[model samples]
Every structure is written in C-alpha cells, then in structure tokens.
Target: MVIIIFHFFLIYSAAAVGLAPPSTYLDGCQPMSCKRGAPSVRFPFQLKGRQNESCGSPGFNLSCNNKNQTVLELPKSVKLLVKRIDYVKQMIQVYAEDGCVQRQLPNLTLSSSPFEFMSDYYSFDSTYKNFSLFKCAGEGWSHYGSYYTIGCLSREPGSYVKYTSSDYPNTDLFHCSRTMDLREVPEGLISDESNNLYFNWSRPECGDCEARHQGCRRNDTKPSGFECFVIPIKHMGTRTKLMISGISIGSFFLALSLSVVLYMHHLHKKEKDAQGKIEQFLEDYKALKPSRYSYADIKRITFDFKEKLGQGGYGTVFKGTLSNDVSVAVKLLNNFKGNGEEFINEVSSMGRIHHVNVTRLVGFCADGYHRALVYEYLPNESLEKFIFGDKGENHFLGWEKLHEIALGIAKGIEYLHQGCEQRILHFDIKPHNILLDQHFNPKISDFGLAKLCSKEQSAVSMTAARGTMGYIAPEVLSRNFGNVSYKSDVYSFGMMLLEMVGGRKNIDVKVEHMSQVYFPEWVYNRLDKGEALGMSIENEEHDKIAKKLTIVGLWCIQWYPVDRPSMKSVVQMLEGEVEHLTVPPNPFASKEEMRAKLPINRELPTISE
Candidate 1:
C-alpha cells in the first residue's frame, strides 16, 4: 500500500508539471457578447454558454435571448436587454426588449441580486424624486401639462397609466385612480422616452482591476472573493494542449521523480527574480533629489512609531524628530501590492515642487517591502479641524483669515498647474488635504493621487475616479460631462470652499430641513433669490465676504470643465473685492437644461498668467 501511494504522488506531480500553464485554462472564458454591437461580457458578468461559471460573480450571470440580445433576468423573471457596460464606473445600462422600460419597471426587483438602481447607489438627496402613478380613463389627459402619459403602457386604448411629480394628483379632474408610487427615482431615470435604466453593483469590486488594465479572477482561497493579476498575452491552442497531454502521459513514470525537484527550483528562481527587479529600481532611483533611507533609519527617525498622528486609506503618519531637531511627519505606506505608482507619484511630483504653499519632501525610505515618506510637520494640523470643529470664536479663523487661506491654497494649486516643468493635477483637493502651519498659512499636501501631463495638454485621460466621493467632479465619475483637466481640481476646491462657508459637509443628512440636505444647491437658491445666507453673520462686511465666496465656489463647480475658471483667474477673483465679482449661472440646474443653455462650441478658458 505504501509503495502504491508513493507511485501515485509521483504520477500526479509529473502530470501537473507537464500540463499547459494556467493561462490557457482561462482561454475559454475570454470576453464575449451575444451578438455584434452588444456589450462584451467578462469578469463579474458571464454568458451561460460562452464562458465558464467561475469567470463571473454570483448573481451576475447573463444570457443570450432568441433575438441575439444580451439579456439580464432579474429575480422576478423580468428580463432587460443590456445596452452598455461601464466597467470603470461599475454601471450597466439596460432597456426592455419591447422598447418600453415602464412595463418592466413594475416587476423589476434588484433585491437578492448584486445590482442596485443607480439612484440607490449614489444616495444623494437630490436624486430622490417621488412620483405618483395613476391609471386614468380619458382622452383629454394630454391637456393636463403637469402629468406625463406613459404612451407605451397605454396600449389598452381608453385606459392608460400617467405619472406626475406630485405625490397626489387631482384624480377627479382626469378621471384617474392612483395605482402606485415610484419613490426615490433619479431625474435621469424618470423620463420614459429614453427607454433605458441604469444599475450599479458593489460586490466583488473589480473597478480597480479594470482601471489598471488588469484581469480579475476569483481567489482560490474563497468562493466569492476576487484577486487581480497580470493577464498573459498568449494562450495555448488546442493542438498544443493535446501535444502536451500526450507527452505527459507517455513519459509520466520516466520524469516523475525529477518533476517535483524542478518545480521547487522554479518557485525559488521566480521569487529571486522579483527581488532583483525591485533592487534594480531602487538603485536607479537613488539619483533622484530625495535621499533614500532604510527601514532601520525609518524606525530611528520615527522612534519606533511612538506617536501616530493620523491614518488614512494609503498609510499611517507618525510624528518624528530629525537628528538636527527638525520636527517631521513620517508616513509609513500601507502594504500595497500595486506597481508602486502612488509612491512614485508622490516623490516625483513633490520633489520638483518648490513653492512655499506646497509641502516639501525631506526624504523617503524604500527598504524591501517597507516604505515611508518624511515631511516638515505642520503644528496647526489640517484646515478641516478649524472649519468643521466647534463654533467657538477662537476656533473660527474668522472670515478675513479664511479668505486669505483660500487665496493661499489657490496659489499653491496654480503653482502645481503652471509653475512646474510639467503640469501637476491634484486629484484630491478637499479641506482635509490642506495643512496649516504655525502661522495658519495654508499648504497643499498629499500627492498620492496626483497626475502629471504637459502644460500644453488640454485634457488628461483617467480610467477611474479619484478622491473622496462628495468632492469628486461630475466628469471624473462620468466622462459625458467633459474631458478631465485642471478644472477637475477646481471642482473639488469649489466643494471644499462651499464647506468652508457652510461650516459643515456639503452633503449633510443631519440638517434641519430637506431643503438644506444638499448645501450647495441651497446656497445657490438663496443667492439667486437675493436672500440672506442665514448663517451666523456679524455685520454687512461679513455678509459680502460670505456671498463672494459662495458665488466663486458656484462658478468653480460648473457642470462642464470648460465652463469652470482657471486657478489663476480664481486667485484673482479671491483677491479682488466681492463687489467686483458677478454671480455665475446656476450650476445646480438639471443636466439637460444646463446642456441646452451652454454652448457646444465654447472653448476651455486659457490658463491666465
């Protein structure tokens, strides 16, 4: 029995070692669509006949219908044809097969599935618009302007379903009876004419993989989890697989003992090669300006990380003191498995930045897997503490100081945009990233999400949205708004500026009334109506400062990047008096209305000197 077990182990090892590599196993699961012009299916979405079950996440299976359309069947047997898939945004657009989305909307249920309606995924207060659906029997319903008739659902002649923005429509006037209520529908999803419905998924998050142009697969350790890896370019053909299988079977016993030894040696060589590559990169990077430190040096400078200042998604920051009595903040990067893009971005961008308003990179540590960044410590901490903290007078930096800080931040951003050899766009520009010195001077910090492009380049290509959700620009989330550029940073700055004025987050669910849920829109309405801002104002001067900042922020957050002002112009607007500034067009209007009003041929404003 012992001899037989040993022989079986040898045979298994030989067969495994001689078979084709794992890359060929995925060849059958490559991206495919039901028909031409249909959305291609890959990870997180698999076609039943075309791809293996392991290729897609649970509850994400798609199938081809009789008409060769990609069909997504919901829990209630409701089927919709897939129109498009935005892997970067994790969104899928679908429509009914019969060109009537409303007919299927009543039966569409996203529960028990990995997907959610787009409105539910965003959870923005503005996206919540409840409408009442009424079944009416009348030919004169067209005269009622407030209600919209569902033309497709009205196929039964006299009786048809009509929907209105009001919660309770005058049923008697139209001889109608309220049938159902559609709650929390987004404006984009309200119109039936488009016949398209949008959905978003959050499970088995593969957006990061898609953004990096990598392939994602289920982890062997778990059934539902996923891991990203480099995709091999070539796949073994059927003939190659057949030949390899034949050879393995023919020489199984002859090569059995040697296979195990060779496999162990191969594993050792791969690890050594990876280490060698990292060492080579570090050696070449020594020529850069920032001094490279070892892990031991990092421990000494940080005193074994005795005092942790803050922690974020990327890393943890500790307070440290240099040998020369210079106080510094040392950031120990997280155990990231990426290609060191974040570390390279921070060092390359901040090393070239010399402005007083931008943070200076003192040095960095890259010993094996451990990485750390050292910077001059700001005693006052971040601007977020002062603005969003208690309402005490001492904590409030006052309107004048706040204005000065805003100008300083603008100058720093302008320096990043135009002062450097290559234009640097800070993808994250919230109040939390704005550090304050002992004198309360604002300095922009954190370059992990920064991107560099030529100053002459009008736009920068981005695969995924970066920065905090509330501060991210519309275009970053969806390219339909416009190409991403320095204007993206301006939009984030605008959100932060508005937060400064509102003394709270831009999206505050704890507000007293629903009107104030979206603070920016509320601010716009007040300014448009020429009403007082209602914030605790001391006098006339303070009111003007508040109004000026509000208007400027509104201008910075225009829907299209082309409509936003440059950082240089923003700095001038901040330096000038409030009286000289004019209120920009309302940016909170509906998307369709705003697009129709704005010119299609409008050129992006040139960066002012």
Candidate 2:
C-alpha cells in the first residue's frame, strides 16, 4: 500500500509537469515585421482576431484600425497607433493618429490596463516644450495669438482653445471648457500631425522568458498559466555558444553544483525570514478585534470556492454563506508580492472600522499562505453598475437616491479620516469600490491601497504612486502638486462625485467633440459663464440636486490639495442649502493670471428646465 501511494504521488507530479504545453505552440506567433517600417511585433502583444487568445493575455491584444493601421487599446477605452515595439527594451512607441495626442492624454489612465507609461523615456528633443489644449467657450482671443483655435463648442457660443503654451489657462478670463496634456507638443509647433507617446509593461511572462533565450507559452500548470520553456540553440542563433572559453563540461557542472548549493542556502535564509514575519503577524494577530477563521473554515464557508463573485488584480471574491444563513463576501487573495501586507492592511483597517457608511469585516482567514477576508454581503453590488450602465433596474435609481449615495460616501470617507484611532487614507476611491446595500446606501469597501497614519501626521510618505489614475490626486501623482495627505482622498471623492452627477465617466471617450470630452472641465466652463448645467433635468428638484452635487464636486477637485475642501466640509456642503454654495476659483486658472471671473453672489446655476 505504501509503494502504491508513492507511485500515485509520482504519477500526479509527472502529469502536472507534462501539462505545460510546448514552446512550439507559440511558433505561430513568431516576430512579424510591419511593411511601414514599424517595429517587429512579438509575444505578449499578439494581433487580436488574427491570433488565438492563448497567444496573449488580457490587455495584451493588438488590432488594426479601419485604415489598416496597428493600434493598441489601453484602459479607459484609449487607443494609440503602434509605431514601434521594442522586444529588447520591452517598450512600445505609440503615436496619436491625428497628431493631437493631448486630446487622448486625459484618457491615458493605466490603473485598469496591464501597461504603464515609460517613466524613463521622455521627449529626447531638447527643443520640445509642453503645450496644452483647452476646449473653451467664449470670445475668440485673437490677441492671444499663441492660442490656436480648434473648433466651436456645440453646447455654447465659445470656441475651443485649440492650443496653449500653458496648462493652467487663464480660465477666469477665458471660459475654458476642458484641458488635457498634449503629447509631442513640439510637433504641434511644427506640424499638425504625428505625435509620439511611449508605453512600457511589467508583465514578466514574455519578457523574462525572452531574456533567457526561451519562449513563453500559456499552460494550466502555473497560477499565471504562462510558462517559460527552453528554446533550441539553433533558434537562439548559429554563432551562439553556451560554454565558457576555458571551462570544461565537468568543471562547469562542478561550478553549477556549488552555485546551486549557495542558492539553496540563500533560499533557506529567505524562508526563515518569511517564517519570522509570519510568526510576528500571528503574535500581533491575537490583539486584533476581528474574529480569525481557520483555512478549513474558509473553505467550508465558501463551499470549496464554488461560487465566484468577482475577481480583480488583488484576488478573486467568492460568495459564501455561514451555517446560520448569513451571506458574506469572501475574498481569496492571490499573487501577493510579499509578507501578506494587503491581508494585514484589510484586516487591520476594516477590523477597527465600525460605521454604517463603511463595510464591516465579519471574519478573516490567514492560515499559512491562504489569506481571505469575509465581509457582509452587499445585495445591490457596486455604484458603478447603477451609475454608468444601462443594466436592468440600475439606472432607475432617482437623482435623490444618487444624492443620498454621494452623501453616504462622503460621510464614509470623513469617518475613515477622523473616526478611527489612526486616520486611514483610502487611496483608491472610485465608483467600483463604493458598494451599495439593498437600500442603495453607499458603503466604502476595498482598503487594499489604504494607508494608516497617526492622527498627528499631516503628510504620509509614499514610495510609489497608488490609486486609480483617473481618480488619483495631482499631488499623489507628483510632489510638485502638493504634500500627500488626507486631501488626496478628497480629490478622488470629488472625481467620483462628478461622475455621479454627470452619469458618465469624467474622461469620456464617446463625447461628440474633444471640447466635451472631460465632463468636469466642461461643467466648470458652463458654470463660470453663468450658463445652465446642461443636464437632463426631470424637474426643479432634480435640477437643484444635480447642480448642487456638481458645485460641491468641483470644490472638492481643486487642482492643488490645499485648494480642495476637507471631507468634513464636503459633507456639510452636501447637506447644506444649495443657495448658500459658491462657485470656486477656476481650477484651470493660470498662476500668472489674476482672478478671471468674479465669484457669483447667487446660488450655483441650475440646469435649464
């Protein structure tokens, strides 16, 4: 019986190893050279529709546009022409088709995409200067000769400020609708076409394999499924040699053995270090307020991971029911980089949080490497489905309900900032993270990117950028904006509020013209011009609510962190009379210019009935 069990284990291991498909399967995806002097396309970026899904993962698919030009689609529905793909550097140079890359700049958010803009690669041209395009509606400032006219605004009488030398336009003086960072600004100075942008990806599947003279193929044996397999020497090159000039095969084997021994020792030390961290976490775990469940309890509660609720970059969420008929959301964490920091973060933050606006943590499982968090089940799901989509019953939530939801969210954020023993800053605050209960009341969920600081700490230090791109504060993006503080969460909240008011994304791609693209900037222009809010108002109350939300949102989204209001102030503004509210200084106003428009004495302008 012992021999049979050993043989069964060996057979299972052998089958697992054999499950990895051959690199030959990827031979179909061999480098393809473009006819237009474009870079050779290779693994990770496969031609969509032409290549099988197995050839590339999500966000790695490429396609040819209507003009037969290769284009790469990014997060937030952004598409750029593929000018060059450098396998050697693992970077891609993209160009905007119309040369006005600035129009697409606001949409180049990568939080949802697998790619990132290359930080190291900037415009190498010394003569290049950053130019901005503002889509404004007002008198044509022909005297400001530097300002190029793009087109006329359809919603109002203003012409789009086609191009400008500054990002912060004199919005007080110029009724600018929207502004976006223009890529390849020098090109705009010369020609009206051909703008270049560079993007890089950190997905290791293809790049790492390529570096080792091997090819990557998708198989089910690994978690990510993509595996690196050895390529034949002949495929590497005819002139390539594997051996050192002075070393014999036997000597190489002996040296390899020694290296392996050293590597094993290093791994052993790493294991010990990991174990120490785990033991420390366990020691600290006893003090936490939340209930800790064993791995078996987690599996049993989740019914062997039967029903998956959803999945994201962090991990997959499963629907679970306790023995007492209470439903819960169980998030099984995966692809954690180190030491279970995310697990600790959620448990630590949510465990202490006890508010109606914030989601409650019912229990947690941190057995060995298996980490999961259980939260109260939210029946209505995320605010995104209701706010953005045309799904059944989602859009029927009246403007009043939307107002309540926004207020609940503001209260939740205010609680996070002040209610806790330590102030928790939720870096990622968007519609998707805002969960709605059965009554449509909002509860802020997902604290994966949350940072806890002492109540006395005015600013928090961040080594890398956190939060979603579209909602991320300008300060968090760069220190030049301002110090990272509780105000960062305020910026994200403002963006979310604007989305709720607009019933669309802030950086919408489907808008009729570039002038109407960024919803917030467009609304600001109308408000500054004393024009109607230009929304689909059902009645006077709906119009008032929409306008109120818009004004409050604009106040929250001030360009500088200091300019923005605190969550406490935001909640007050939402609950207070709309008549008492005032229009904020134009966020896009330039530093050189004085106040462009005088502050309005009356209430915020309402949408025309």
Candidate 3:
C-alpha cells in the first residue's frame, strides 16, 4: 500500500488542515499499472489502493471523495473533478463550464488543480495544437491558467495563479476577490490540462522510488507516497496523546491568525488605490456631461415641433422660440441612437475654436435616455436644401450671395483643418453638414468624426470607413486606396461643391447618361471643353461662381489622398483664378469599377477582415 501525505500551505492552511503522517507508507497495496482501471494518479500525485498516506509535499495532496472517484480538496483550496490523469507529462485536466459569454466574464472560477510540472522536467508543447499562452486585457486584468488543449482556446480570468496548496483546504492561488485580477502566473510556465491532465516526474515511478529516493507523491504528501531516503521505524513509541493534541490546537489557532492579517493588508492597499482612481475619473469626466433641458422647455422652444422644419439620420429639427423669444433650431436628438457624442464634440471644439462662421453649440439635454441640442436658429436652413431640394429655395439666392456662401464655408473648413491650434479634420463635411445663418453666411457643423491633430501630425490611421458614401475618400476604405490624411475631407467638400453647382446629388445614377456620369469625370469634360463651363444658373454671376466651385471641387476630389490640396490651398483656389486651376488626375474611373479596392497581398492571420 502507498501512503500519501497532504500538506496545505496558505494563510488559511490551518483551517484547511489535512492529516499529516507520523510515518511513511507501511503496508498492504499492490503494484500499479499505467493502464490500471483503478484511477490515474499522475506525477506530483499517487494513491494507495487500500492504505492511505500523505503525498509529495506538506501541501500538495488530494483525496477521492466518498466515491473514491471524484477528486476534491485539490491543493486543499479548490475542488478538481478529475477525468483522465496522464503521467507522462504532469497535468490533471478539469472542466470549467459557464453558460454564456457575459456570465463567464464576471464570476467564473479558476482551474482547480495544483502540483505543477517543474520547469526543468516539462515544457508545454506550444506549437502542437495552436495553443499559445493566455493573455490578459491589461494591467488591471488577470491571466487564467495556461491550458494544454488539442487547439488554442479562450478561458476566463481567475483560473491561473502560480502558488498553490500552500494552505489547508486550498492553495496559494489567492484572488483579488471582487477587485483587481489575481490570476497571473509570473510567466506561462504552469499549464493545466484542458480536460485530461498529465505529468512528468523523475526517472522512476513510485515502485522504483524506494530506499534512496523521496518527495515523489501521487494523491497525498510525504508520509503516504513521498519518495525519500528510507529510514527504519524501529520502535512504536506509544503514548499520551493529550499534550500533543493541545499543542496541535495552539498551532492551528496561530495559522488562522496569520491568514486574517494578510487578508486585511490586501484590502487596505486596494482601498487606497480606488481613492486615487475616483479623483482621476472625476477630472476627465467633468466636461463630458450631456446638456440638460426640460421637456416643457423643448415644447416651448420647438413650438411643439410645429414648424415641420426637417428630419435627418438623427432626429427631427424644428425652428422654435425660447423664453426670451429667441429664435432657435431645436434638434430633438433621436431616442433610438446615442449621438450625444456629437453634442460633446461640437461643444468641446466650438469652445476652443471660436469663429463667426462656425455654428456654436448653445446647449444640450440628457434627460433619462432622451438627448437634444439647442442652437441659434438659422432661418435659411442649409445649402443642401436650396441647392438640391425639389422646392424653389434656390430662386431666392442670386449668384453673388451663393458665391459668398461658398466663400464663407471654405473659410470655416480651412480654419478647422489649419487655423485652429489643433488641426481638426472634419470627417463629415457635406452640404448637410454645412449650415447657413440669417446673413447668408455659412458655418461648418456636425463634427461627429473629427480627428484632432497636433501641428506635428497631419495624417492618421483609419479603421472601418465612415462619412456619406459619395463623399468618402478612397484612402478611408483601404490603404491600397491611398494613404489616409486630412485630404479625405477635401474629397467630401469637392463632392458638395459639385452638388451645389449641379443642383442635385453629383452621382445621381438616375439620368442614364448623367446617372453613371460620375461627377468628377463630367465636371472635367465640361471645364476642358470650355462651353460656358457647361452649367447655367438663373443669375449670370452664379454661373461663374458655380463654374469656379466646380473646377476647384474637382481638383479636391482627386483619387490619390496625396493629390488633394490642403484646406488653405482650397481657400486660395476659391479666391484665385479659374485659369490657375491645375487639373487633378481621376482615380475613381475604371480602376474602382474593375477591382477590389484593397490590396490582396496583405494576408491577415485569424482576423475576419
């Protein structure tokens, strides 16, 4: 029979006590086989068929529950449900099943196994099945245990802790309990079985571990299956057990005390850390609060949403009157989407970049889930309405006023992209994004995708493409499309310019010849042919402004991101001669129609893109 000793070494090891041995294994068991149907007890563990003894160390011990099947009290702290234990490589595979993803994220427990394979003895077969080391979200997150699976797998945090079975009924894998993660093994040295664990030990199995060998255990620790130098147990010293029991009680009490002290110390440190985090959070979140407004205030302002002003991707806009009888446009931010970020973006940038041509963010509302923004009403609405709408708002503005509107818009955008301390790239810059005030002056608005750049950086990486499809620059969709830079905004503005001249969406796909006419291509043909620059406005000067805008806009919409002009140059061109305009190469013609926009050479491993 093999006697295994169970030893637990944690602060709470006393409460989780195991029966230590007074002597090593003394009798009655048969030799075990690797294929034995009895039960597989791998390295760092062993089991006596009948006789019971402690295993390896004072703490690395485990025992079969009443069934002599289910392994529990593993490392004395966690319960391990053993399936098949492999001895060739030291590991015990256990199952960790949680129902859903969100559920797994929070309370999922760690792998309940101890008895790690020594670094010198075993190394995980990493390349075998695509199983790599476990990674955490970051410093605040925890690493679950390393897993030896047929393939790579994702596991919850709290499953990996370097220290184990240092205490009774548990191990040294202490967790940060409802706090920071505590599951990082200094490195990925220790790996647990995905489902079936295996272990590698010194040359001989327990049978050969006789006279000179020690420390080899199967299920329990030293006294039971511990392999060590053989010493003769000569006499059975008997005795009075009373004094010994009292000493044992005193030791147990002492162990219990040490655990409490350590636990308290951990909590104190966490409290101090939390205090610092709160202060930092308050400072950052101070200016991010959504604007506040009352439903009654909304009713009075929007005139009960009466004017029937307009509807957009977000919500309805109504011209209204405030208590001071101030005329304002109340945008009842939609209930379905969270666009309050636009409110924040506008307010933050507007406060920093003050310009008369820029629409000011007056105030906002974040009531329950309801959000809204209040701004001084621009009775003229937007350029898109008059220029593109079926209605006759276009008849009201003659050529010179239209030219002024165009100049004002160009100045506002140029200021955002260059004049401000931070070069703000207004990603969404189209007719709809441009609002006009009472004096027929234009103010750039809607900066939901604005990217802030220092004087140092003028370019940035783009992810999934954004902005209106017709207005999106090629570089935004893929690097092969071109290098992404502030010029992408130039592309959108160009599309808007053509629309202002054509009196509708540039690429209509509606009028057959003009439908697929591809605005950029059509604009170039008209300018090169020099037949009135091909567009006619009711007012003659409107024709020149329209022609000038069309040529400059075509130049801005060039295919390569680099081929586009800076907003400063755009303002210059708008103010400059039509003859000075250099024609920009058109990259959107057959190339876009023929091939996939992105390069095929870059093979992204594992990423679905």
lDDT digits (tens) for residues 177-206 of candidate 1: 888876555445555466767788877888
Candidate 1: how large is its RMSD? 35.0
Error of 2 at 104 (Å): 99
- Which pairs of residues have clashing backbones in candidate 1? none
- Give the best candidate by lDDT: 1
TM-score of predicted model 3? 0.46
Q: Any runs in candidate 2 off by more than 4 Å, and if so which? A: 1-288, 336-339, 390-394, 591-609
Alpha-carbon runs more than 4 Å astray in model 1: 1-288, 390-394, 602-609
Candidates ranked by lDDT: 1, 2, 3
Better of 2 and 3 by TM-score: 2
The TM-score that candidate 2 achieves is 0.50
lDDT of 3: 0.58
Tens digit per residue, CA lDDT, model 3, 520-560: 66767766776555556667566667778877888788776
Flag regions of model 3 displaced more than 4 Å. 1-296, 303-306, 389-396, 512-516, 537-544, 587-609
**Comparison by TM-score, 1 against 3, better one:** 1
What CA root-mean-square deviation does each model show from the true structure?
35.0, 38.0, 29.7
Q: For this target, which candidate reaches the highest TM-score against the unseen true structure?
A: 1
lDDT per residue as tens, model 2, 206-252: 67677777776666678876778765422322222232212234444
What would the C-alpha RMSD of candidate 2 be, to one decimal place?
38.0
Model 3 misses residue 427 by how many Å? Answer: 1.5
The candidate with the higher lDDT, 1 or 3, is 1
